[model samples]
Target: MNGIDIHNYVDCNDMFRAAANFFAACCRCAVAEKGVFNVAISGGSTPDGLFEELVKMKDSLPLEAIQWFWVDERCVKPDAPESNYGRAAKKLLNRLQLQLDNVHRIEAEKPEAAEKYEKIIRTLLPLNKKGLPVFDLVLLGMGPDGHTASLFPEKFNDLPGDKIVLKVPEPEHILPAVPRITLSMQAINSALEKVFLVTGNNKMELLKVIKNGQGNHYPAAGIFQAAWFVCCKPGSQD
Candidate 1:
């Protein structure tokens, strides 16, 4: 089994660079093999820096051939302030001048949005050996409370079985709580590559536990075959 690999950095700039390099590689590999690169991005304060770095990659990579997707989303209007789709647009997509059709966003506000988004994903992506739609790359962020995407600690083991996408309601076990739609574990694990962008001292202890392999109890550790780009205060041991 491919386990999680951790890489620590002194600042987010280096972290974003590493992620952008890995991202460029995934894009090239996917495009060469399938003519399109499917990418899913998580919404958080951490990935914003990575997005900024990626926009500058237009000169070095095939930016136009890349298609974008969201890893999870708040159940709000697409243009809403809290929407992940909105955040990504402001941070990177608009800057890239990507063909608007290539940026697929989840209509999280619709009553049937989960099913609708799942259909969109299925129609847009190719399947892995496991018969799941495999994204070329999936970028994630871990909550200080140990959640990844919207699979919170409170509902870690309870994500929907048959659905490719799940709806998460705010629960007492999580902080910064809100309703959300997220890919299921099976869907996320099927990615060709999974990269986590972790930053700040707030996550230091959590990263320690995760590195020590004590994070199985937390929702964030459920993602498989992942690499973490961590930036934190000094003296934090790997």
Candidate 2:
């Protein structure tokens, strides 16, 4: 928490640029330190924008040294329109043309995909002092209900302490219905750093409540220890 930072952007484009720059810098640092950058990508409209920026950065960034993972995945086909991996592949991976060995996606359509992905992550990345994988960075999106990744408020406490990944139970009536696999709070909290990209006026009031410290009940509060880059307070623009 002491190292966490928060930023606000005037628009999504600005947020995307800031995210891309930070990610590139992190990747470079990871490469210099350990020869690889292990990052988890979040699925959502906001990250699509960030991925767009990443695509444009292919030539300048340390693309080959980066290893990618999903923060969470819907139990759908990898190419499904709603799939986070699908969106990212189209927006960034395809265009960046990074190595196949560097990209690890959750086979969410499989019955044991959650466990399988956990094992894959374990084999590829080093564990921190907590025995949890320390992702260099994990990009997170906050839903209107304040859910981050697939971790909803109602089901947060039920997550097993030792499990790195788990099948998410259905959300409490507000979110879209879909089976999801998510990294546990321990895994998420273990990241070396995290970024929360929040946008638009719809979330302004909720953001105010969160900033005022009245949102302890929200799932996003679980990672309030991470960096947050919100946007365009009410009506102002870049």
Model 2 CA lDDT for position 118: 93
Which pairs clash in model 1?
none
Model 2 TM: 0.93
Cα lDDT, all candidates: 0.84, 0.83
Off by over 4 Å in 1: 173-176, 235-238
lDDT tens readout by residue for model 1, 93-127: 88888898898888888878888989989888987
How much is 60 displaced in model 1, in angstroms? 2.4
Compute each candidate's TM-score over C-alphas.
Answer: 0.93, 0.93
lDDT for predicted candidate 2 compared with the true structure: 0.83
Which residue pairs show backbone clashes in model 2? none
lDDT of 2 by residue, 164-217 (tens): 998987677644578899998789889888898888778767767776777878
